[model samples]
Structures are given as structure tokens and as C-alpha cells.
Target chain A: MMLANKQVVLKNYVEGYPKESDFELRSSMISSHIPQGSKGLFVKNLYLACDPYMRHKMSHHISNDVPLLASFNPSSVIIGLGVAKVIKSADADFEEGDYIWGMTAWEVYTLILNTNGLFMIKYTDVPLSYYAGILGMPGLAAYIGFNNLCSAKEGDVFYVSYAAGGVGQLVGQFAEMKGCHLVGSASTDEKVHLLKSQLGFDDAFNYKQGNDLARALKRHFLKSIDVYFENVGGNMLDEVLLHMNLCGRIAVSGMISQYNLKKLDGIHNLFCHISKRLRMKGFSEFDFWHKVPEYLEFPIQLIREKKLLFVEHIAEGLAKCCINFCWYLLWAKCWKEDFSSFN
Target chain B: MMLANKQVVLKNYVEGYPKESDFELRSSMISSHIPQGSKGLFVKNLYLACDPYMRHKMSHHISNDVPLLASFNPSSVIIGLGVAKVIKSADADFEEGDYIWGMTAWEVYTLILNTNGLFMIKYTDVPLSYYAGILGMPGLAAYIGFNNLCSAKEGDVFYVSYAAGGVGQLVGQFAEMKGCHLVGSASTDEKVHLLKSQLGFDDAFNYKQGNDLARALKRHFLKSIDVYFENVGGNMLDEVLLHMNLCGRIAVSGMISQYNLKKLDGIHNLFCHISKRLRMKGFSEFDFWHKVPEYLEFPIQLIREKKLLFVEHIAEGLAKCCINFCWYLLWAKCWKEDFSSFN
Candidate 1:
């Protein structure tokens, strides 16, 4: 039997920033049955992640010229993370109707190869779309960044930047689960409420309205902040250093503020990291990918048991894909609460 | 019985930065016999340490307004870290002619009290001045920073900033002794040669002459920087972040570059920490003070066994004390490799 597929392809190489014209929507045909000796699996893509990390992948020069991140090839599909159902499979582990999720494309169907740690979503009681964000890469990032890298102890106070975003939201909740006092800074009032009320953070503030970030942190943290999960940098990171406790741990999860800027800002309070005996480590989820199987189980159980709550600002269809993607990206960058009125 | 004595004291509080006018030398009287019920001893100071950490004591503004370390009060004898020989004592553990090293005054003769963890210099066959540095606080800082904080493994590539300074010089050698490759960045060609030739580092360079720090690091360490002992911050730190290995560990010992500056330079490459899963930790020797008893014996033994080497830049005479102290404070702020040229 033959199956139909819709594909999204990159039209050309992006230079400084990505525009809507860089992507093109097209159609293709696929065979539904598995072919012998083929490791590739045909997946029906379900939920696609609109992540800030994707922003780094959108540009070629910054990604290619700098040896820091993987470069995206021109004229190829803009690859990203997605939750997909395995509709046709030739891989030994996956089969027809087997619900799995990993790094799929921004298309309706993708032929996935090299399935090293692409986990099958066995736990179906919760939202499968979570495989794209909270229960997937972002969740692993949060766990490893907070629990492992920082060595978060009970009663440790945490200040998370972008606390309402994909990884930030989960990190806040994970901090709560560890019996830590958490204060998050989001871009919107709704995110502030979501962090404090829905997510059970000790306190939260809108970084958009706060004139002085150091004062904002000091206001909520009273004594000192034990751990700082830095997702957004620029002045926010500089301010957090002043209030960090002696021997404080800062897990560098992301720095979205400086990602798009042509010239990056330098932090003034970095010297405080030495004086206070603070630890600031940068980490990514790629290293902790081995822990995904057991790691994914925790978030899935939390969602099913009603212990962990998550909010997804999802876009509906293919026509609104680029606009929805931009909306989430911008919201994630600035204060989401400020833009809630438009939503 | 009255005895002749000598002491050093601060004339007044240093305002902006320390100058020669801040201290005064005085001659007083002391008893040869230990005081009754004092469990105290009389000692002659031999060598003292002029450390950058003492600069924090010069002003009331440093240490978050706490008087943890303040320069000697006006009209009172000045105190510092010194190696002293016991002349007379009543304490059961200490006796006459016993050589000991600890936090002491900048004077010829002194009465010792509150001897907490003060031990006899068991291995003193080498220069007694070694006890003030490689066998004391600086040595312990190097050991703990490399061993405990960094979890430094064999074959790991190491980098130390302020590599000619007391602690950094030892850490570079220690890395070599541990079968790891070492590179050090110092202020002068002399220090770079000293690091490579004397201290047993694989390679070394003058960070002062390096135009692009990131390029310099890439040129030296083509592989990866496994551990970074950060004694100098600002641009050096930014470059190190860009070239750090996956799961790299950074020991935050000091940041001399931005010490006096009210506003510090920015680090643009911090986002790599997250992507690379790097570990950056800040520490002080004071936090691990409890382990001094266990720590003291190792470095003392290392120096005695000829496994460890150290150098000290001492200025003679009490008259030159203020000028000498300023030299150390300035050295801490900038790259000073020509200690011999100061005379």
C-alpha cells in the first residue's frame, strides 16, 4: 500500500536571521509497508516543538563559522524535534501503530534513520505531544541541569530565568519536587501566575517590568539564591550573580538574549562568582541523552498522576506554522505575559 | 620580666586603594616566658605572605560590608600570614625552637594566642618561606581546586590563568604530576618559560600579548580544555568557554582582571556551557578550613620529597612594607612577572 506525505523544506541558506520565505511546503508519496534491511522508519509527525534552541539552528553563518554548534546545510529541510507515531517501520524496535517520539522533521511524515536512543512512548495515558518538549529533550535538560549538574540539595533556593518556557517551566516544577524554594522571572504576568499558582513556585516576577533585576532577585530571595538556572542571559545573568549564595551553583541552560544580537553584552557582576565561591556550569541535554528512558518515565508518570502540570502555546495547522512558530519564539525571548493580550 | 619586642600596625584605613602611608612600624616589649593560663607562645616572624586576598581587607565596602578581613587598625600592630619560630611556650603541643606557620602579624617578635589547627612544620629542610605558600593556603587551594572541585583526571588538558602566581604555579605542576597535559597563561615571557621549563607545563604563553584570546586558546589547545583554573577573568574566561571540552570543569579561584573595576567585562561565550555540559564552580580556601589538618601534611611532604616546587618574591625591611604591599596588590590586579625589576 502507498501513503501520502506533506514535507517542509528549506528554500535557501539563512544569513543573519531567518525569515518566513526561507521555508517551503511540498508534498510526497510514501509506501506504507516496511522494506527489508531498511533501518529507516516512516513516522506520521504529530506534535512539533517550537523551541528557542531552534533559533540557533536557523542561521548558517553563526552556526557554521563558530565551531560551537552544529551547522544546518542549505537547501535541506529545517530539521527540528517532533513527536511522531510510527506508521510504517523497517527498524527492529519499532512497528506499525507504535507511538514513538524523537528528532523528526517539520513535516507530516519523516523517514527516520540512526535510531540510537529514540525512545518509544510506551506510556500512553498522558499527552503524546509532551514527547516533543516537557517529557523529551527539554525535560532531560532541566533534570540534568538542576539535579545532576548543580547537585541541588533540599532547601536550596533557585532563581530560574524564562521560567514559563518549555524547559524553564519543567525546571521550576522539578525544583519544587526536590523541596527547594524556587523564584522564577518570566516575561509575562500570566507566566508569573503560572509559575507561582499553577507550577507551585515559591515566588515569581515579570522581568519585563522590573527595572533592576538584582533588586528584583534580592526582594524575593531575602538571604541568598542557592542555585541559578540561567536560561536567559544579558543583564539578567549579571544581576543574579550579586545575590548568589556562597558556593552557589549556576547551571547554564541557555542564553537566548544574546543569541540573536550581532554584538553580545558583557556581564559586570561575573567577578562575584569568584568572591562568593559560586559555581556556574554550562550544560546541554545531548550528554544526558542516555538517561532519557528512565528520565521520560518520571515526567510521564507525573502528567498521568496529575502531579506535574504543563501549558503548551501550540499552533494549529500548516498555514499558520511560520506565524505560530514566530509567535512562540518571540514570546519565549521577551515577556510572554505582556503578549497574552494579543493571544 | 620585661623583654624587648617589635610589631607592625596600620596607621589608618586605606581609602580608594592601599598606599605606603597606611602602615607604621613600632617597637614594644614582650616576655620570654609564656603567660600563665594563656596556653600561648612567643615567636619570631621569619617570612610573611603578600596576597591579593588581603586587598579585600583594606576597605569596609568589600565582603558585603562585613568585617571578615580588615587591615590592622590604626595604633595597633599589623597582622598577616607568616612562618614563625617558637622561642617560648606553655601550650602542651608547641615547644621552644618548634617551627610553625599560620596567620600571623607582620613583625619581628609576637605573642601567639587562639592556636586553632596550628601545627609544627614537620618538614622544614627546604626554604622556610615555602611554608608561607606552596605548603600552606595556596598549596591547599591548588590541591582542592584540582582534585575536589575539578575532579581532574589523568590525560586531561588543563589551563591556569595567573599561572606565575603562587597557587596557579603549583596547580600547573600538579596537573603534570597527575599525567595530565598543562598550559598556563601568564603576564610575561619569563613567567611563560618558567611555567613550561621549571613547572613542567606542556606549553605556556603570555596572555597579555594575545590579541584574540579564543584564537590563542585554539592555537595552544587544539583538542579541548578539560579543566580551567580561573585566577584571571573577563575576556580570558569568555575564550575558555568557547573552547571548553564537553563536561569541562572550571575552578573559580580568583578574578584579578575585574577586581577594582566597579563594572566587569562581559562573557559572550557562556551559552556553550549549556551546549557542552560544562561544570564551573567557585571556591574559597576558607570554606574548606576544617580540612586543614589533613591538608597540611600532603604539601609539606611534597615539598620535603622534592615532588613540588615553589617561588616567592619577598621585599626586605619594615620601612619598605607599605611599598611592598602595594606591589602585591598591583600584581594581583595586573600581570606582573618582573618582581625582580621592582628593586
Candidate 2:
């Protein structure tokens, strides 16, 4: 049997910021059944994560050395993590009618040739879309970063930049639930509003409205910040350094501000990293993979208890040019949307 | 009972790079005996460490919140750490003819009002000047930085900037003794030569001669660098960030390059800290005071075994104007002379 796969393909190598015109929607035919000896599960992508890391893939300038962030070839199907139901499986680990999440192409159906990356869905109590965000990479990143790196404690003053985004919002809620006073910053008023009112952040502000981030930080935190969950980097990291308390920890999750630039902005005042005995660690979710079983238990339970609230902007099948709009927002270093769009 | 204490005083708060005219040599009379019920040690100054941190105090712009670093009034005697012999004592912890090391003024005869800060010289068999450099603050800094923060391992590729300086030299030797391959960078050819030839660094380079530090690092460390002992920050730190391997660590002991700047040089590559899961900690010796006894044993034995070598540029009764020379070199952010000079 034949399957017609509608795919999003890179049209050319992107430069600086990716434009909508850089990608093309194409249709291709593939075998409906999993190929023999491939030991694969055929997946139909349901909810694709609109991530900033994907922007790095649209460009040819990326060095090949970076793990898990390899550039996509021109005219090739864009590979990403998404929620999908297994339609067919040559591997015994996955069966038909099973819901799963793993590396899938931005297409209607994907033949997952390598079963190594496939994660079998164990629980079906929550919305399957949650697997693409709060229960998958972004959730794991937030969990590992907050628990392992930040070492957040009750009554600790916590601040996270880009706090309205996928991982940032989760980290802020986690800190707040731990009895930490949380301050967050976002690119727009709505996101800031959602952060303070909806997501339970103690305070939220529009970073775009501030002239001096240092003064802004000083205004809110008259004393010092204990843990800084650094999602976006550049001037924010520099200013946060000045306000960090003794033995403060900075967990660098992403530098969205610096990623698209031909040259990253310079950060001064890192000397505080020494004088105050600061710990600034750059980490990925892979660092805490061994704790996955132990890590997933709490957040899943919290979601069930109605104590944890997550904010996300849902969209079905992103408009072709909107991908450029997304990349433009990434270049702008923050989103203007409610939270995020999924396709 | 009257004694004339010769002193070097800062003429006024210096702005930018200091000049030779910024200091004045003066004399003042003080009682030779300890004051009644003072519980102090009357002592003569022996050695003073010329440290970059002292430069932060010479300017009025310095914030008062910094631990243990305070500014002296114009025309007042400069205060610094020194090795001394007690001439008289009212404290039970000390007696006449006993030697000690503590924070003291930049003068020949001084009355140490706070015996609390003084450490009685138990290990006098080593040169007294060693207390000012290796066995004192700088040595303690290197020990804590290498063992506590770095967690160095055999077969690790280690790099230290300003590798012939007091703390840098010790860190490199400690790494080398740990069976790590060591690379060092210095501002001058002679210091570079001293690093590899005298201090046993596997490779050394003169940073002044190179414009491309990333290339320079790649040349020396063909593979990834495991540990970086950052003595001098700024552009060098940016470059080193590019060469760090996965799970690498950076021990930021000092940022001499930025200490005297009205504005510090911007570091652009700190994002690598995240990409590589790097741990960059800025620490001081005060954090490890409880472990002082446990930490002191191994290094003293290393010195006793002749397995460790230390570099010190000792000068006695420095001209008042030469303190400005030290300040000038501090603004330049590297050293032309060796360890220090004192009056």
C-alpha cells in the first residue's frame, strides 16, 4: 500500500533569520507498512513542537559538532519531536493503536526506521498533546534544570527570563510550588499577564518595556536572587549577575537572544560569578536522563491534582509563512504570541 | 616608646589607570608598646602581596558591600596582608619574637588591634615570603579552586591563563601532579617559557603575540579541554569557552583583566557553558575555611617533598611611586614584574 506524505522541507540554507520563503510544502509517497528488517513503527505526527532549536536547523552555518541539533539538508523533511499514534510496527515494543512520542518528521505519517528513539506511551490519562510539551523534552528540560541545577528551595527568591515560554513557564510554576517567590519576564503584555495571573508567578514584566534590565531587576529584587533560571541570555545574564546573591546558581537553558545573531552580544560583570561564588551551568535535559523515571512521577501527579497550571498557544497546522514569523520572533529573542503554537 | 612608621599612602582616589604621582611617602609616630587592654600584637611588616583586588579599593567607585576589601582615606596608610614578627603582645595566643601573617597596614612597624585576623606562624621552616604568596591567600585560592571547584582528573586536558602568576602557577602544578596534560598562556615570552620549562606545563603560549585566541587554543589543545583555570578573564575566557569539552569545568579565581576597568571587556562565548554542560564557578578561599586543616596537609607535604615549585618576585622598601607602577600594570591587566613589592 502507498501513503502520500505531506512534508515541510527546507528550501535552502537560511542566513541570519529564517524567512517563510525558506521552506516548501511538498508531497511524497511512501510504503504504508513498516519495511522488513527496519524494525520500525510507522507514526502519524499529531502535534509538532514549534521550538527555537529548530531554527538552528534551517541554516547551513551550524557546525556539525553540536549533538541533537544537526542542520537539515535542503529539500529534506524536517525532523522534530511530536505526539503520534503508531499505525504499524515491525518492532515488538510498539503495537498498532498505541500513542507514542519521539523523533518524527513534520509530515502526516513518518516511518520511524530507528526504534531506538521511539518512546512507548505508557499512560493515556492526560491529553496526548501534553506529550509534545509538558511531558516531553520541554518538561524534562524544566524539571532537570529546576531540580538538579537550580536546587531551588522554599522561600528562595527565584527569577526566570522568557518565563512565558514552554520550559520557562514550567520552571516558574515548579519554583512557585516549592514556596519560592518567583519573578518572570516575557516579551509581551499578554504573556506577562498570563505569567502573573494564570501561571502563578509572583511578578511578571515585559522585558521589552524596560530600558535598564539591571535597574528593573534591582527594583523587584531589593536584596538578591537565589536561583536564576536563565532561558534567554545576553544583557539579562549580565544584569542578573549583579543581583545574584552569594552562592547563587544560574541554570542556562537557552540563549534565544544570541542564537540567530552573526555575533553574540557581549556579557560583562561576570566577575560577580567569582566575588559572590556564583555557579553558572549550561545544561541540557540529557544530563539527567538517568532520573527520568524518578523525575516524571511528581509533575504527572501535580497535573492530576490541579495544582500545576501550564500555558500554551495551540494552533493546528502552522501557516506556511508563519514558520518565518516564528523564526522572526526567535530572532527578536522572545515571542509575541500567547505562549506557543503547535502543528 | 615613640617610633616613626614610614608609610605609602594613596594621594587621592584614582580614576582610570593610576600614575606615579598618585602616591606619597610619609612618616608618623606610634607607640612601640601595645596599648593597655588592647589585646593586640605590635609587629613589624615583612612582606606584602601586590594583588589586583587591592586596585578595586584605590578608586572611590568601589561598592562597600564587598567582603574584607575596604578603601582607605586619602593621606591614610594603605592596608594589606603581610608577614610580621610580634614585637609585643597582649593577647594569650601570641608572645614576643613570634612570627605571624595577617592583614596589616603598608608600614614597617604596625599595631595589629585585631588579633582575631592574625594566624600564628606554625610552619616557619619555609621562607616567610612563601606565606605572602604560596602558603597564604594565593596558595589557598589555588588549592580550593583546583580541588574543590575543578574536580580535576587524570588524563584531563587542563589550561590555565597567566600560568606563571602566583595562583595560576599553583593550579597548573596541581593539575600536572594529577596526571593531567596542562597548557598555559602568559602575556610575555619569558613567563610562557617559565610555565612550560620551570612549572612543567605541557605547552605554553604568549597571548600578546596572538590575535585569534580560539585558533591559539585549538593549536595547543587539538582535542577538547576538560578544565580551565581562569585567572585572567575577558577575551581569553570567551575563547576558552569554545574549546571546552562536555562536562567541562571552569574555575574562575580572578578576572584581572576587568578589575581596573571603568567597564569590563565583554565575553561573547559564555553560551558554550550551556552547549557543553560547563560548570563555571567563581569562588574565594573564605568559603572553605572549615576545611583549612584538611586542605593544608597535602600541599605542605608537596612543598616538603620538593614536588611543588613556587615563583615570587620579592622587593623590600619599594619606592612610594612604584605602587603606582603596580596600579598601572593592574589597569593593563597583566604583570611585567613577578609577585610583589612592599614598603
Report per-candidate DockQ.
Answer: 0.58, 0.81
Worst 10 residues of 1 chain B by lDDT: B62-71
Model 1 Cα lDDT, one tens digit per residue, B185-278: 9877777777887788899988767466666787899888889999988888988887788788888888766555545677877776666777
Q: Which portions of model 1 show Cα errors greater than 4 Å?
A: A1-37, A61-68, A332-343, B1-18, B21-42, B60-78, B87-90, B210-212, B332-343
For each candidate, give the TM-score of chain B: 0.87, 0.92
Root-mean-square deviation of every model: 3.6, 2.9
- Give lDDT tens digits, candidate 1, residues A1-343: 6667766666765444456676777777866655567687888888877777777766555424234356566666657777888877778788888988777777777778767667888777777877777788888888788777667778998788888878888888888998988889887777788788888899999876757666677678787888889988888888888788877888888888766666667777776665777777777787667888768767776787889887766666764565565555566554453346434
Per-model TM-score versus the true fold: 0.89, 0.94
Q: Is the docking of candidate 2 incorrect, acceptable, medium or high quality?
A: high
Q: What C-alpha lDDT, on a 0 to 100 scale, does residue A11 get in candidate 1?
A: 70
